[model samples]
Target: MHHVTQIKEFKVIDTCRDAVVINTNIDDYKAHAHFADIRGALECISLINRGLLPKSRYYKTACKRLLTPEQYEGLVERTKEKYININKGVRR
Candidate 1:
């Protein structure tokens, strides 16, 4: 028997002095979003982490800092579970 695991990871695909692009890994088409800066990008990530925003939609960034390491890890775990439950009804 074999067991397979799927890891959902987001990547920062591009960065510039005034903007950054991150591949959010939530869409089948590999959707990416643009932010004015790293702080903005991280803020979007944080909102997604907290469940305050929906994963299937693109969001604009706000002027805020990233979450703490511990906070982020906890949120990631919760988000993963939520995503799994949400996908249970859909056949892939």
Candidate 2:
């Protein structure tokens, strides 16, 4: 069987009262580019755009639960956390 890949997208409307989830697959190299580590900072913001999950609190919950691996999990996680929380409400 072929392996499955998942992408999450969120859209929000009316003071967070509306939300949705759109799913897609990354079949090639470039398809995964949108989700690169350099892109992690805007992940939650992007998720909000499609509406699957809420912003702020959900993002904070995700950040707080992030665990680092002993080897390849330091700079990436730290940078992502900083970018995600820098403005909290605004995503840059």
Candidate 3:
């Protein structure tokens, strides 16, 4: 698989087109602990900061960051059983 270099990353992802257009007041993945948890290194941030992790890692990071250690092992399992509902899809 190919990955982008940081110096050239900006060129690949343009903000004018990728910005979130959802309601600011609503709590989506950004507000949920899941986001921070999934984004391994970004676990320290509590509030929102733009362009934290690469777009590719968003949903995996969300699943990791928000869930507890115990939950991580079970989340996907629960999802398979239709017990967990995650909005892993990107917001339009």
Candidate 4:
């Protein structure tokens, strides 16, 4: 039998310069690093975009509940751009 992947929808519950909270059908998840700056957050986002799940157990679980790889890549791209704009005020 062929297995199919389900693409789940994600909602940005809250976000700031240093952190973001996301919600999906499975559960709510937060992405943040204590004592880290915006750069750290950007790095984290990059890793996620590259298919590297966060080290935190909660994040690992949440990653499994997210969208398919293709859909997720699109979401990550948009999110990264948003963060960059908010932090650097870069207009494009």
Q: Quote each prediction's TM-score.
A: 0.39, 0.20, 0.23, 0.29
**Model number with the top TM-score:** 1
TM-score (C-alpha, index-matched) for candidate 4: 0.29
Tens-place lDDT per residue, model 2, 1-92, is 22222334322121222222222232222211222232343464444344334235555443223211221123232223334555567856
For model 1 the TM-score comes to: 0.39
Q: What is the lDDT of residue 82 in candidate 3?
A: 58
lDDT of 3 by residue, 1-92 (tens): 22221221111111322322222233444423222222332321211223222234564454344344454455322113456547776577
lDDT of candidate 1 at residue 92, scale 0 to 100: 71
Model 4 C-alpha lDDT per residue in residues 1-92, reported as the tens digit of each score: 22222223323322333333232443334421221243443444455657565665554444544544454444432233333445576667
Off by over 4 Å in 1: 1-8, 17-21, 24-30, 54-92
Candidate 4: where are CA atoms >4 Å away? 1-11, 15-45, 69-92
TM-score order, best first, reads: 1, 4, 3, 2
Candidate 1 or 3, higher lDDT? 1
Q: After superposition, how far is residue 43 of candidate 1 from its true place, in Å?
A: 0.4
Q: Write the per-residue lDDT of candidate 1 for residues 1-92, one digit (tens) a residue.
A: 22222223445433444444334433434244556565656666656545454343345222112222333344432255334576567887
Q: What is the lDDT of residue 83 in candidate 3?
A: 60
lDDT of each: 0.42, 0.32, 0.32, 0.40
